[model samples]
Target: MNTTTEDTDDRARRSIGARRNPASQEAILDAAEAVLEESGIGGFSIEAVARRARAGKPTIYRWWPNRTLLMLDVYRRFKNARGFPDTGSVRGDLIALLQNHLLGFWKDSLCGTVYRAIIVEAQNDPDAAKALYAYQEERKKATEVIIERAKARGEVAKDVDGRLIIDMVVSFAWHQLLINRLDEAMGSIEGVVDGVLMGCAGYKR
Candidate 1:
């Protein structure tokens, strides 16, 4: 019944990951986020997260396949903080959503840097791109929910194509991100949201 030193090391590595302790898992994510916020992606490393969370790097790596995968968790946390705006007016809701995104991208230091890092990683990593695009699809579905809500409230035509609306929004946001023109993008959100909604709300005679 003798256990080798290697067996002991293996058990230690698997213990945290295999036990499935929610608190420990959450702490790791929290630490990762804190590192990003304080130092951006430049300072985010396995050793840093391990130190901040007071857990071994092996434990963190076991849960997430790589740094990119772990970053997805961080991105999800911040994105979830601001849910779809439901301000009764479809136009108002969209304007609000656009404004928040623009401001976050331009004014929020932590958010801007972290998102930029993720986008850059997506450019080179197929797995990262897949995760990011899948998340984008999820968001598109969420936007459709807002569209449905608008229809329920009689603010939009029942025939509105939610997917088209989502495409427009996504394109505008990325255009701003790519061009580094947050000011213009922020100024144009109202116009863009209103103009597109014209079709959704139907033409008035």
Candidate 2:
């Protein structure tokens, strides 16, 4: 058996794609993101992404294990790009975080498409559902941290139900994502936070 030089080089390239060239890894991720945005999860496949990225399917599999994992990574990066806000006030911070996320949802942003797809996938896939629940809990904790900070600063009522406050904000965010209306919606996050705080913390105006 004779392995030609061209075959040897091809094998090396396939085996070491992003290892040899970091740019290839980024290109693959970019292609994956595009595939997700254009086709959602149903149309996404390692072969399709490899074709779009000009990389081998093995290369993608080496990095991500499964389509869901890859998609999760892509969404993680997308969400991290904006991140939870820290605008010095709990109300302002909540508004900033929810507003940024909701605005993207209403615009049909790539992140929004991927996010909705993840939610639907979780409905039928237990593994996906676990991952989705974990991610949701992470977001819930972020909002909970804001409430705790308010409590420490004497901004929140000691008698307020912290757990309830967390649920209120998390549910409100999820509701907005589910409905996703964009027609002149004015200060929607502000409205949610104001109402919740008024009831939970006895906030003034």
Candidate 3:
């Protein structure tokens, strides 16, 4: 007796629906990252991930629904695990964040690839763009805390817009990733932070 692909897929989906544990979720995410790393976004798909994880397309869909969502999860999982920085001063914190993104994971790990894929996906898929926007908002809110902390310490202007500062910083990082110049961007992180802070200084009260 041999099991058909349909039979295997049904079993996989049923198993997941019956008992979706953390380990299974982690395995799917792990497979997603591996697929993105190996095939880039062009080759990334539910089928690819399912095959890699020994899962079914229905199971992956039940978990992520779309490639963009799955890719975002893959990107977010590692980011949460890496956490954020708090080096006392806003400059130090900003620089640390930039370094962690540009020189650390974005350059040296799978995060760069995963995020790059997300950006590309956003260009073509409206849902992906929306998902990317929502994801960025969440990240921006997290980064805004750094500015709020600076405000408390009199490091930033009371009237300064933290979102604008985040935009500048994020835009710079995005450009570097797009151009494949993350390494060179490292030398400019401090300069970028200084420019943002200096521009925001006039708002100090």
Backbone clashes under 3 angstroms, per model? 0, 0, 0
Off by over 4 Å in 2: 1-27, 37-42, 62-65, 102-108, 158-163, 182-187, 200-205
Q: Against the hidden true structure, what lDDT does model 2 obtain?
A: 0.70
Report the Cα lDDT for residue 82, model 3.
72
What TM-score do all the candidates reach, one by one? 0.82, 0.72, 0.82
85-198: candidate 3 lDDT, tens digit per residue:
888999998898899854556998878877888899899998889999999999999888889999999987799899998888999999999999998988888888898877
> In candidate 2, what are the lDDT values of residues 20-59, reduced to their tens digit?
3444555777889888778867799888898888777887
As a whole number from 0 to 100, the lDDT of residue 183 in candidate 1 is 64
lDDT of 1 by residue, 6-111 (tens): 7655654554443335556677788998888787788888888888877778878877767887888887777787777778888887887777754444445566
* Comparing 2 and 3 on TM-score, the stronger one: 3
lDDT agreement with native, every candidate: 0.75, 0.70, 0.84
Off by over 4 Å in 3: 1-14, 18-23, 37-43, 200-205
Cα miss at 2, model 3 (Å)?
Answer: 37
lDDT of 2 at 123: 87
